[model samples]
Structures are given as C-alpha cells and as structure tokens.
Target: LPAPILRLAAVLITSGLLILGCDENQQGFLLTNRPIVYLGDISYVVYLAHWPTIILWKSVSDSTSLSIFGIFNCLLITFKISIVAHHTIEQFFIRSKVKAVSIVVSLIYGLLAIGLMFNVPATVNTSVASRAASVDVAAAIEWNERVSHNAYRQHRPCKECLDDPEGQRMRGGYTGKGDRFECIWKPDKANGSVKILIIGNSVAHLAISILKPVIEENFPQVELVRLYSMPACRPTEVVQYVCPPYHKALPKQVQAMKPDITMIMYDDAILFITSSKIGQERKILKKTFNKYKV
Candidate 1:
C-alpha cells in the first residue's frame, strides 16, 4: 500500500479499536475485569521492557529460540517486572513534581561516571612496559602481557571472535574490540578504496580477519565494512532477538555504501529449529538471502 493508504488504514483501525473500547452498550466485562485492567495499565511498561527481556534471555540461554518452559518463564518474569515498574518508576514519573527528564539525565550521567571509573583500567591500551617505565623506581617488575598468547586478539576481541576454551586460551579475557560489533575498515585512501561489505555472525569476522592481509596485499583496492555480527544471528525470517536489527540496518547500509560486493558468512542452517521446521526455515533463509543480496 502507498503511504496515504497505509496511514488511512492505520487511522481507521485505531478508531475502530477506540470505539470498541469505549462502547458502554456492549459487554464491558472483559475490558472492566481486574486482570484486563491491570494488563492495560502495565501494557506500556511491557512494551518498553519486553525487548530488553528477550535479549537478556538470549544472552543467558545462549540460544535463539525459547522452549515452552522458557516462554512461560519469560512471560512470568516480564509481567513481574512490568507490574513493579508500573507501580514504582512509572507511577513516580507520572505523579512526581520533579522533572522526569532532569532525573533521567542525572541518572544517566551518574551511571556513566560509575562505568568509566570501573572500566578505565581495562580500556587502557598502553603496554606494561610503558606503564612500568613511567613509574621511576629501580624495582624489577616482570609483566607477562600475553595471557592466552593468541594472535587473534590482535585482530578482534578473542571473546567475541572465538567460542571455544582452546581458542580462548590464546585470548586474555576480552579486548576493547569486544565492545563493538560493527565498524568500517577503510584501506589507505591513496590506493583507491573498494568498498566490500563483510557481514553475518562472528564467523564472518573471523573470515575477514584471516583474509584481510591477503586482501591488502593482493587486492589492494578492497576496503572492509563490518556492518553487523551478532552471535546466533543470520539474514533469515526466523524471529531471533538479533535478526531484526540486522535486517533493519542492511538496506540502509547497502543504500549508503553501495558496496561492490557483499559477503555473508554464517552457519548454513538456522541456529535453533525442530526437524519439522527445517524445510520452512530453509525457504525463509533463501528468501531473506535473495532479498538482501546485492
């Protein structure tokens, strides 16, 4: 549908819903019921928190899809959180004399200050040798900078790039690279940069890291663009916590960059699926690939 038609349709639908909701003549039992009224009260809070809850669930489970048990637990948790937020934060903001905007800004700055204080040591990129040299005492201090001694840490965060303990041994915890999931790598502008979009999950990151030197040496014109890489996420129709952002951003990136090539590297099949859903997932995956392909 066109923009006007879509807007008209949305208005009509909303108006219809409003009319039905306000209808005194019709049976109001469902709308007036305590449970329904309570849900209505907390619906906005649920709207705001549901997405973060799902992402947190995915992080905790390390899986894309939820089981029946997981869904029940999620709903239970969401409702509990929503009810609490509705009664406390939501009510306070709605009813308080103090400006909500000012309070929110103050809270944000306070949390930022705390985070900076805690994270400053980890983000410091200077070598132990450099720090040791700065302190002017004649005490012999031996610092073993390499924890896992894995070369992969030089490319990206070993935590983000590697999954196994064996690979992790090479990575000393997470490098600052772990904090970023996406960035564009620009080759030297003097050589003439060729934009090649590198996308998909961590495998794509690994692939580019391995192949990057070869590209720079052989294909001197190629510039790497890392758009998105979320674990257990791919360009597919299957509803995972990460897929929506990937899909939403792809077209915008494509439009903006107009890359000469778009390379997708991920697991061939959906991360989580039943035997029965494989065929359906395969079709959806194919469709998504077709849609996103440049």
Candidate 2:
C-alpha cells in the first residue's frame, strides 16, 4: 500500500487497541491509569512548546550549541513555561468559543508574513542602487589604497598581479609594468587619432595581446591606450586605485595620452561580489568613460 495509507492503518490499529483496553467506566486503560494519561498530556505540551522556545532562545543568544548543562537549563525553563501556559493560556483558549477571533488573527499574521517576503528583493535593489550612486571616485580610490596597503602586510604577492613575460614576447615586445598591464601605442605626438583605452582585471588584461592586433588591423591610425588591473578589481577600482597614482592620475593621464576609445573589461563574477552596492561603481566607471569618450 501507499505510505500515507500505511500510516493511516497504523494509527487506526493503535487507536483500536487503546479503545479496547479502556474500562467500561472509561476512566482507565490496561497499560496504566490516570497518572499515565496526565503524563501523556504533559508530554504533548513539551513537544509543541520546545521548537519555538529553542528558536527564540537561539535568536536572542546567537548560539547554536547545547551543552549538557545548557540542555538541562532549557528543559527546566521549557517545563516551567509550558506548565504555566498550558494551565493559564492553552486551557483557557481551548475551552473558550473564540473561533472567529482566532481565524482573523491567523489570517492577519499570514498576510503580513507574505507581504514582507515580497518586499525584500525591492528593498535590497533600491539600497544597492542608492549606495552605488553616492560613491565618489576619489573616496573609492582612497579606500582601495588602504585595502592594498593592508593586503601587503600579509606578505604574499598576489600572483594574479604579476606579468607573464613569455606572453608579452610572443604578442610583440610591448613594455609595461606588472604581470598584466597595458601600454599605449602612439604613432606620432602631433597626429590626432581615435584613442582606445582598454580596462579590465587580469584575465581581461591577458586578452589585451589578442585585442591589440585586432584593433591595429581593423582600425589603423587610431591610438590604443590599455589600462588594466590584476585579479578581479572592478573598473571603478581601476580608475580610483590602480590607474590613479599607480598608472597615473585619471583625466590628466587620459588627456596627456589622448585616446578616442575606452575599452572597460573585468570578470563578471568578481564584479558581482565586489560591486554589490549597485550604482556607485557603475556611475564612477561611466563618468570615467564619458570623460574619454570620442
């Protein structure tokens, strides 16, 4: 038989046994008497009250573990509360004809819970967007500087920041600093051409070798200035941290080099983690791009 049917059969069999065992007076059973019935009633109280009690306790304490002593304490408190609530609250409510009040209260509580659940995503999105819009490029740059200095204290060179010399030689002898870096290709100082600034993290930086040839072949006479950072630094950080001070200052750096195109790149996974505060980084990136847009 199906599981539900099997479970129903079991319950029916057990109930039949209990009824059969009951005395003609219906005051006692074959297994025990009034004391056993009372104990069973208290056991039901304990089972019903234990879970919510534990949840509330954990929420307040921020604790998940229960030692032997803790378990004893919990049981003591649970039993005391359940006994009082059962007598003063549960029995009163059960005995009362308050069906209408109970139904209305339950409906209100369920509706409120559902409303809060729907509102969560909208709240998160708005908060993230507002935070992003407020980010100042200068402020972000300063934060990055502090973070980078602290990171250096850990005494490990981020391998992602190192340049691949073999990859560089194979692409063509373009000179640049770091493991993944960008160098501008200028034909002449006086000649005006479309400037392309490529920005991204390490993987995007490596792809620059492939991109350089394509750009050169397709768009001849256009000057290409590559701006890149390592690992998974977002474009906002590239502007604030890596590019400014390290690569050179932003507008001044771009203007002096004079480019027509700015290619911004980075790992989407990295951006998702670091740029959780929606608008700030995106705004900074767009602002920087607009400054250099031709």
Candidate 3:
C-alpha cells in the first residue's frame, strides 16, 4: 500500500461513490432503511456527542474491551446523548432558521467543549480571585526585578514550565559533554512524591507523551524521575545514537538519582543487532545491578 497509489485509489473511489449517489432514480437500500434514516437526522450530533464519552470511558477503563455488554453500553449511551442533542440543540437551531445564531452557538460550544476537554475551567471561582488578590505588591516588584537579570531562562512558548528548574539536566541529568540540562526535565513540585525513572527509545518517547499528561492530571504528587532517551539508544548501551552523550551514562545516573523504581522501554527488534555484543552488554548491565545493591 504505497501512499500515492492508495491516495489515488481513495480519490477515484470517493468520486465514483459521489457520482453513483447523485441519481434520484437509484435510491439506495441504506437510505431507505428506517433505522438509518432516523440515525441520518442525528448523525452529526452522534459524532459530536460520542467523542467525549469515548474519551471519558478510555480514561476510566479499558478502551479496547470487546465484551458484548460493554459494546452495547457504549453504543446505547452514545445513542441516547445523540437523541437528546438532536432534539434540543440540532433541531432547535434548524427550526429557528438563523444561520448566524447557529454558527455563533456552534463556535461557543466548540470552544467550551475543547476547553473542558483539556481540563480548562469553564468559570472562575473564589479561589482564583483570592489568589490574585493575595499577591503582595512588594513581592511582585521584587520578582519583577529578579526577572530583569535572568530573562533568558523565561523562554517564551515554554516559560516557567513544569519539570524541576533546579534539578533538570541533560543526558538523563548526567553531567557529560555539553550542557544537556535543558533536555532533561525533573519535577519542580511533589517533594514527597514517589520518584519514577523512565529510559528507552522512540517507542518509549511516544508512550511518554501519553504518560506525562496522566501523571500531571492524576498523580501530580509523583516526580517523573530520570527520563533519558534517544531515538535508537538502548538501555543496554549497545546501540549508537547521536544525542545526549549517553554512552555508559545510565549506571552513574541511576546511582546518583536512586529512583524509587526504574522503567525501561525498548524495541525488541533491535535485540538481534545488540545480540552481537551480548557479552559486553552483560558486563555493562551487571555493573548497574551491582551498584543498585539490591
């Protein structure tokens, strides 16, 4: 399935389907079906309503569960929401016959929905106001003066970010080669939180994208410990990578940080290539184990 050929085929198929559907003479069986016709009226509403429900369901439980009852429940819930949305929101707008009002409502709903999805507040409360009111003028002025000198640290687009400003360093916080401090991220908060160290390859990085959000939202107390990784760098230190200057760096970092637990992510396929140097890998890895003193 080359991309170009597949794309060309998709275009041709879509065009053919459109051409076939343009006929008033050839009424389709699906279009004539009672259930489908009912669904067609609220199809857009179903699509809109289902996404949030699915996201919620996934966050709470297994998204890929194939149990028949689970599938039925998901569909039933989505259908019920779609019915409500169609009758109340969708049909109300259509009957009102105000395209401008509909567009405005749509934009407002979309923005609010997107905000809530990202855990943004829909309304400000007393706590927010209280915090703003509590800021002292003297402290603010002092902070402003401090910012005047070390302004580069406040890089725009990522200013005062998460990850410990104090402890962050590159090469998994290992002091090696050039400064890799900016590349490494440690927790600025969660002083009493359990430390977790994660090291791995590209796949691991993708997992981190999903992980970082969950940890921030649910386990904010836990510090994300050493996160040393590059595209092809193996925890076994048998692969060559261009970044982080990580050759023989993991053991020293592990001893230094003393993470509560260490997690390693790697591509098993690379094992074949690494197998060539298994003896050296064993020796290097054994040193890490011995230092752990477990």
Candidate 4:
C-alpha cells in the first residue's frame, strides 16, 4: 500500500476508536472501565517519567538487570511519582481558572524539562568529558591537513559526464575526458595496467582508499576504476527510486571497459533489496561477470 493510503487507514481507525469512546453505551467496555479511566488520567505522567526513571536508576545503581524485588520497587516508585505529578502538575493546570497563568507555568515547566533532558545525560556520564580531554587535538589537526589535499581521491563529482555512460576520466589525465564522477587510478612506473573496476557507493570509494597502497605494493601494475555509484544504486536490477537508469547503464559500461577484475560493494540498501528473488540477484551477477570477461 502507498503511504497516503496507510495514513488514511490510520486516521479512520483512530476516528472509529474516538467515536466508540464517546458512545455512552460503551461505558462498561475495557477502555471506559474505572481502572482504565484512572490509568488514562495518569498515563501522561507515566509517559513523561517511566523511561527517564529507569535510565537514571540504571546509571546510579550500575545494574542493567532488575530482580523481581527491584522490578516491583521500580514500578512502585513510578506509580507514586506519577500519582504526585498527576495531582500537583496535571490537576493544577486543569482546575486552574486563570488561563494565562496556567500557560506561563506550563511553558516554564516545559523549558525546565528540556534543560534537564539535555544536561542530565552529560552530567550522569562524566566519562564524556574525560574522553574529550583525552583526544590529541594537535595530531588530529595535522592528519586532517595532510589528507585534505587528497580528499578528491575518495570520489569525483562531474556535471558534464552525466549523460555519457562510456565517458571516464582517468587519473593523471591519461584519458583526455571530462573530470567526472568516474575515476581510474593507473600506476606511474608500470608499463601495462590491470584495470580493477569497483562498483558501489561510498563503501567502494573508501575501500579504494584503503586498498590503494596495498594493491600498489603487491601489484604495481593494477589500476582501480570506479563508476559514479549513487548511495543506494546496487549493481543488481533492484526496483528502487534511484536505480533503473543507473542499473541499465552499468552493464553497458562494464562491457565497454572490460576490466580484468570487478568489485561490487553495495551499501545497506542490500538489506532492503534482499527480499528480491535470489535467482534474480544471481542472474544480474552472472551478466555483470560475463561483461567483466576480456
């Protein structure tokens, strides 16, 4: 179902529940029973207090698990806190005749709650400050400066090569083409280059960065080639929003380049597309491998 349809269904269901709640004949029903009514009255306070109480208790007590006694005590504490909050905070606002005074008080309480929510976490875990103190800022700054110049080695973005699937810009301007998203790294000293095509998103780009030195050390003649891979553009013919055109273009590009080795490293999009037929994935893989063959 589409998102709009799902949203409409949710709205209809909630409206139905509201209609039922308003019906006097449904007073004896589970939702309208005395205990349920009282719970509903205090539910707002429970929503505000329960998780924070549990988290604060866990941090202070240094215990992840609660025994039966501990569980009972936690519930008791929560109940007591909720009851106090319901009477003092909730009822005070509800019963107060002065609307402006109530709004001001509520806003003040809300601001206090927001302040505590952010500040309490930092205060609770003092080690966050210690971790910040431990970071070597000078070393980090120096490393950043060194790698900042070579940042282009990660990924190239070019507007001119968008329409041309066969177009590629080789490193060192070996091929006089648009300096586009496609990148081909060739060895300087080697006479011949073994093209290794990488197909995927940022994972493929980062892999190239990490593997470049290792490949250069072991096989100086190897070249690392990367195509313009959008984040979710898996090599397979998966039905995704940003996929169809890129998917169709990929095999043609692979066939044209005829790289000696092809490396396909998709992002987390694979998890979503895994529901697709395994045979379909295999079929795409076989086709891509066939194109890689010289």
Model 1 Cα lDDT, one tens digit per residue, 102-139: 78879999998987888855556455447767664443
Better of 1 and 4 by TM-score: 4
lDDT of 3 by residue, 1-294 (tens): 334675899799767756756876644864787775787798788788777776666444422222345445677899999998888877777887688777878999999899888666734555575668867968987766543323322431122234443333322554434312222344465554456566665434434444454445455455544455444445553323243356466666566666655657654321212223234433443344334211
lDDT of candidate 3? Answer: 0.53
Candidate 4 lDDT over 114-221, as tens digits, reads 979889766757767567787797898776753342453343332211233234322221221222135555555544445556676444544455445455455555
Name model 2 segments beyond 4 Å from true: 1-35, 55-65, 101-294
TM-score of 2: 0.28
Q: What are the lDDT scores of the predictions, listed in order? A: 0.55, 0.50, 0.53, 0.55
- For model 2, the run of ten residues with the poorest summed lDDT: 152-161
After the best TM-score superposition of candidate 1, give how far the Cα of residue 142 lies from its true spot, in angstroms: 24
Candidate 1, lDDT over the whole model:
0.55
TM per candidate: 0.34, 0.28, 0.31, 0.41
Q: Please report, as a residue range, the 10-residue window in candidate 1 with the lowest summed lDDT.
A: 141-150
How far out, in Å, is residue 277 in model 1? 32
Report the C-alpha displacement of residue 72, candidate 2, in angstroms: 1.2
What is the clash tally of candidate 3? 4
